[model samples]
Target: MESPSDAPASAPSGTTPGLMGPATILPRCATGIEGLDNILEGGIPRGNMVLVAGSVGTGKTTLSLEFLVRGAERGERSLFISVTEASSKLIQNLSTFEFFRRDLIEQGSLVFVDLPVIYDRLGLGEEELTGEEIDILIRTIRDLVRSLGAQRLVLDSLTSVCYRIRKDEQIRDFMLRLGQELNELGCTSLLVSEIGPNPARYSLHGVEEAIVDGVILLWNTRRFGDILRVVQIVKMRGTSHSRAQYVLELTPIGILMAPHLKGGREGGP
Candidate 1:
């Protein structure tokens, strides 16, 4: 893995000369959140699977939506795969945000697919995902990406999928394979997960952290009698990122994260 600074200053074509010599530096995919990209240096390593772990009300979905919306604004096709909510409901919820554009959806620049609907389409019932079932799911997602030419993807709430798998090894295998498939499709992805109250765990299962290229933890802390949303970059491979916990704010337009201030818990919206 090449550090951001070690990456090539310029690339002529297929193979770019870097500090590592004759290596290709993957481009960065901006998350579209204010100040967050700067903290990440430029953006996440392109085609890397990133885990966005947070408990409820931590603005996990909002942040993921903003990532896709921002990518769409940049003319990058984005796909949101929802395992927890219907497409209509998700769209309805995002309707209030200034970044939520119905025109993008209409234009097919942004797309939403419910996982349950895909399962039903494939004639698979609600049960533990076997090897065959997992393959089908991966194929379905890959097909979607290929068809839409998607550059960014968000699998909202991977925790929901983990619940259906019975064995820990199966979950690990599933995540590994899923990440590889997504990477092969040349898409930067966010695997959103609902973390438990335990701050030590990055995801529902401990397997997710090891499978992804990055892990971002979002949580709320009580500071001076106010609930302050905080974001921490636990790990990001191939790029140097700020590890400090920053203040996260949900504004009318989108999320704005700033460095934590001393005794200023009431500053964020």
Candidate 2:
């Protein structure tokens, strides 16, 4: 397997990566988030959705943000929808991450939406979506995607939508509709999911993992009084990726996936 940096710096014209190199499609944009795109073969398929699952403080949001912001840097507009968070609060929290800034969010390149407000105003129970409601919700999202011509998208925690709506059927139906909508609109989306503590059983019911084209699991463990982070390519549909769980770190530079196994916990205060 070629190192990410070693792969050809260009994206293929269309349809696939070098034909048989991997089952997953190579990324058109280098996420700017480290080691991730490598295990993902190149990156998540151009318009496909991926669920980034992990526990609290595991960096799922940060990674997703980096992915979207990186897209902006590449001249691709991006969108970030937080169903459970207020937009102002979400932006404030992200501002402290390595590569986040208000300037980017206000520049029309990285648009943020507070879905919690929308849902609250609608009084929509978890899983309470009727066919009619879904139609409107999708249309709104599509409007945002089209208006921005967004090439990348991030949903802070899609599974929470299940909790808020309290219905699996609705979640499933909405996701199916949303996924197709995103694909048709050419938005590469990262759906953040809060995983259980165990690294193996990261996703809640595996639906999120199953629905998307790829799944990246992030885990953290304490060793010698230091927190060590690890990321694994649980699955990627179109590319041949490294099966190993590599070390990851969140430093002043954002998320970094160290492929070399560097033998332990990353240093930071």
Candidate 3:
């Protein structure tokens, strides 16, 4: 791993060394993923809205699931709002992971809800949501988080949700209010962003990334005749973390990461 000095030299005073090697000023909501937490300094600062941006097959959903599962293991109530897949199918896929505990769902520590179901119930049937409808959507999410007392939340793909929110201004306002609602409830959130490879921006609407508290970017690249998944912290609000890129692996146990060293066999799987 790279040294902590590789982080920003302007890190604020009174920030303490975190679980890994970096420093943070606020309480952390640890993802508990090997190497990732290390890169995050410890974990995401509590109540932060982090954008997990990546192209397809870049392990975005897997990483988000692992984040929720790990949080649930620590006795934190976790919620997953799936936009593309059914909750049952997600749980079925999650069962293959060694670290996954099905009982966590049965025990109600981890909960999954389909965003489509919520939309249907809320009567947000239009392709483009009105500003008033956007408020309803945000309130619905806030209510779910509050009712579940979810300490950690994951939205499978923010792109899917934003597709219905066409205007950049509306998307920005929605994110701002939703983030404020979650932060007020003490919930740390991961909002997945599906983008084309090498996107100019991390989200469907460029403004989505700006409203977020942090951005963890993932993408695929060719290296030594092999395709590799790479991850990096593009931005994080309250922590001094490594901006270095790392190789990401999606394993049966869970997500793993290692520093992306050029021509080094040690990091890549």
TM-scores of the candidates are 0.88, 0.81, 0.89
Judging by lDDT, tell me the better candidate of 1 and 2.
1
lDDT of 2 by residue, 1-269 (tens): 12222234344333244555544334444566657665554566567778888888878887888887777766678899997777788777777776776677768878888886766666655566676776677777877888888888898787675554445566677778888988888787888888777645545665556677878788776666877777877776655667777777777678877753445644211
Per-residue lDDT of model 3, residues 92-170, tens digit only? 9899999999999999999999999988998888588899889998999999999999989999889999998998888
Candidate structures ordered by TM-score, highest first: 3, 1, 2
Going through the candidates in order, what is the number of backbone clashes in each? 0, 13, 0
Query: Which stretches in model 3 have alpha-carbon errors above 4 Å?
Result: 1-24, 263-269
Cα lDDT tens digits for candidate 1, 222-257 = 765988888888899866677877988988889988
Give stretches of model 2 more than 4 Å off: 1-27, 120-127, 165-167, 199-201, 224-226, 260-269
Candidate with more favorable, higher TM-score: 1 or 2 = 1
**What is the alpha-carbon lDDT of model 1 when measured against the actual structure?**
0.81
**Model 2, residue 4: C-alpha shift (Å):** 17
Residue 225 accuracy (lDDT) in model 2 = 80
Q: Which candidate leads the pack in TM-score?
A: 3
Name the candidate, 2 or 3, with the larger lDDT value. 3
Q: What lDDT does each candidate get?
A: 0.81, 0.70, 0.85
